[model samples]
Target: MPHSNSKCWDFCAPVAGILFALAFAPFDYSFFALLALAFLFACWQDISAKRAAMRGYLFGLGSFGSGVSWVYISMHDFGGAGALGSSLLTGLFAGFLALFPALAGYLSVKITPINNGALRFILMPVVWILVEYLRGYWVLNGFPWFQIAYSQLETPLAGYIPVCGVYGTGFIAALSASIAVEIFQIAARCDISLLSHYSYRTSLREVHRDGPLKNLPPLIMLLAVLWGAGDLLRNTAWTYPIGEPIRAAMIQGNIAQDQKWRPENKINTLLKYKRMTEQYWDSNVIIWPETAIPAYLDQVNDTFLVPLGNDAKQHKTDLIVSVPVHDADPDKKYNAAITIGKEEGMYRKIHLLPFGEYLPLQPLSGFVLDMVNIKLGNFTPGVINQPLLKAGGYPFVTLICYEDAFGELSAQGLPDAAYLVNVTNDGWFGDSIEPYQHMQMARMRAIETGRFLLRSTNTGMTGIVSPNGEIIAQAPLFQETALTGTIIPMGGMTPYARWGDRPVIGGAVILLLGLIGYRRFFRMAY
Candidate 1:
């Protein structure tokens, strides 16, 4: 009630936002999201764009800074950079990411009419989603990790995921939060008057009669209808089997990043994989993690390939494995995985990690490895339209590390493939929950497509994921193990896989345009 207490509340507001985000992490307390929404609502009461943006930024900083601290482990422990450099890099990334929430908070305050609770509720989710979509594609490359919708994966609200994707789930969550905030405001009698330094000049008795609550019933009904439709879509079977089941094996070599590329360790790495695969030689298809070969295909010579190829052919097995490939014309290198079976070909990774794979503003080689102590620092981008691989008589989409996490990429590439195959090296993050979180994103992709997803990771979380976001099989973290499973390939597209995020993005754009038009034509006349 006092100014000093209000200041303290303002300072503590970001704590709610941070806790809400942390609650979504793997093995986290999800109930904190309720407190997060309350804090946001309190800040909304202030009705100042600047203050709202500041609160949002502070929240974002805490949310991402603590949740994604695993980035430091990758840069410092695995990338060969020291602790100070890793911390600096991680700080810069977190600071940049925080700006998106700042923008969302500012827009939410600017467009919301303080007296009109209905407008506030409607606009907040729309604005939040618009900012999130921008964050997914605004920079050199976008990082769409740990979106709020992801927290709903294990909840009944998860039904919304297939229809609108993660961003859509986020919109619903924000909308729910806004509704909760409005209800709180009404019950507490903390109206817009609380926001002003001078108050009680206007009688609330008359104002309350003509306010936004009059339209609340219809708005609530609309939300119920939309949520019902989402649930219906979730329960409906929109896809069918494209072909018979394919028996597959995913090998988890658990190779250390530091030792993976070492010449001295090459024999051991090769033998380890060979030994693991020998047991599963009868599998229709077998997969190894990203860069499992750990050397350029050209460097291997026939000495390596002749035996490997002949063995696969003799066993009548399809081996899908990753190796580095060198392009001579451009004098560039690429991280690639090729399928060796009845037919053999390669798929190069289209998206390269900025500093890890290639250096910016340099000649694509030498500089990054020399300066940053990271290995494999000269990979080139793959061709954009590479087709899905045909292995063991089934077409399968393949995604390398970090590639499967991009919803747009998966939507575009996986429709034609009978199922999705993701190979990654999560040893870079050590034993952090990051690997589990990353696997969860892959599961979301599966639900979006209605296709079974097979994920093979080096040093952890390797598993088979079904179309409903269920983990069919998985290995323990940091283990040298192999898993064999039967997966049925499905046909027919889920709403998301066919249409992608267009519906959600288009809805956001239309909402924004309509808001602009409304303000211009019907300038609030009091």
Candidate 2:
């Protein structure tokens, strides 16, 4: 049994340590790479399930608490909430985010054969990955923000993204951590009895038959294969060139969230977008950020619509603009994008941001509403099978604001959309890296679907990404500007687009079930 101070430290240290690591969560220098190592160190002392869970939860709380602290900025700065309210809300969100890692830790210990060091090491990666995957899409509409795979955007490992999505990169990262831990355990063994008791069967044989160097070959080869394959895939041209290039213009009107809803600022916002659009009128297609029009579609009189529609038709161009729509359904409102041109239509956003768009806890929502200064409460979800809009003979799916962050949601609605058009108001988060992170998530979606992703954000990170997750063109942050580029919409699907995360989750379930069954029925011992 551990002492009180030791127990307290054990309980709290992992969380604090993880939080510290996440303080450097930008994509700069592989910060998460080091954080993963630290996590292994924190878990090294105790190999039990309970300890693992506690540590994992702490780690998760720290990682998410720090990395996503930007949420507090939005709530406090823009959500019309006071400091205390924002802090409380932030804590609640972070706590909820921490649950995924808690699950990972608990399940890893339960499934792993701790005494068999090799098996424990092998299974830890699988357990970690499965848990992360679950967090990405399971409970409460799934929040996959700040996934470890996001940090690998600039790394060679990113090549695997087109084939397996970000989740697979996470698996590889976790596996690398496991290997490092295994080495640490092996080095720390002091006695033959301890070695015999804790070492893996393979390790024991390797020690006795061959030297320590014998196992090194497999480890080196495994890493070499992962890195080598990733490099090879990175250089490979997985996407075929389209016969013709589609010229598009992305307008980044730097609208402030505070002034967005005010009646006085409405005209200013409209003019800003219109002026930017005029510059790009020659492009094949022009796009505006999310909720570019502050007023509902019905509320915007023909004065605004007629001229914009005429301009699009006269320019021989299609305009994809985001606007709030209030249909005949008096009770609901939708965030939607309408394409105005020869083939005019609309695509409503299916997945809405939980707290930002729709509050989950209705009773508590009222309390939050009273506390916060924001006027609106809920935005309705669109139908599951919403089709891609056709404009200028190009088929494309439109994702509003944070909707592009979700890999499955982006892929499911339109499998055959020539490409993706993501419209967002990242101005809510200001000049933070939140916009960059959001764009990174959008790139993953492009890779998953093997399509060109054209993201237009109000406060920069507006860019065009290729099918394999490379940024072809990007505007500087916090700049009110417009970028005109030619995007080749790729046809056909990557493995991730065809199946999505189901295969990964299904594989995990099978492995876990098979392990449970073998343990229960056959009484297999490691």
Task: Output the lDDT of residue 41, model 1.
Answer: 55
TM-score of each: 0.89, 0.89
Candidate 2 — worst ten consecutive residues by lDDT sum? 19-28
TM-score of 2: 0.89
Error of 2 at 143 (Å): 0.4
Per-residue lDDT of 344-387 in model 2, one digit per residue for the tens?
78887888887778877777876776776654558899888776
Give lDDT for model 1.
0.77
lDDT tens readout by residue for model 1, 1-526: 4331266656776676578666665755655664575566557554678878887788788777877888899888888887776788789878878888888888877776555565666787788778877877555466777577777677656787777788887788778777766665554564665445334574654354455444455556665776676667668776789788899999999888778888999888888888898899899899999989877888773777657877989989898888888888668888898888565878999987766676654564355445655554767889887978878788788789888777767877656778888989888888787887788788888888888988898887899998888898988888789988999988888777777788898988898778766655555563
Off by over 4 Å in 2: 1-25, 34-38, 41-45, 187-214, 372-376, 413-415, 518-526
Candidate 1 clash pair list = none
Query: Model 1 reaches what TM-score against the true structure?
Result: 0.89
lDDT (0 to 1) per candidate: 0.77, 0.73
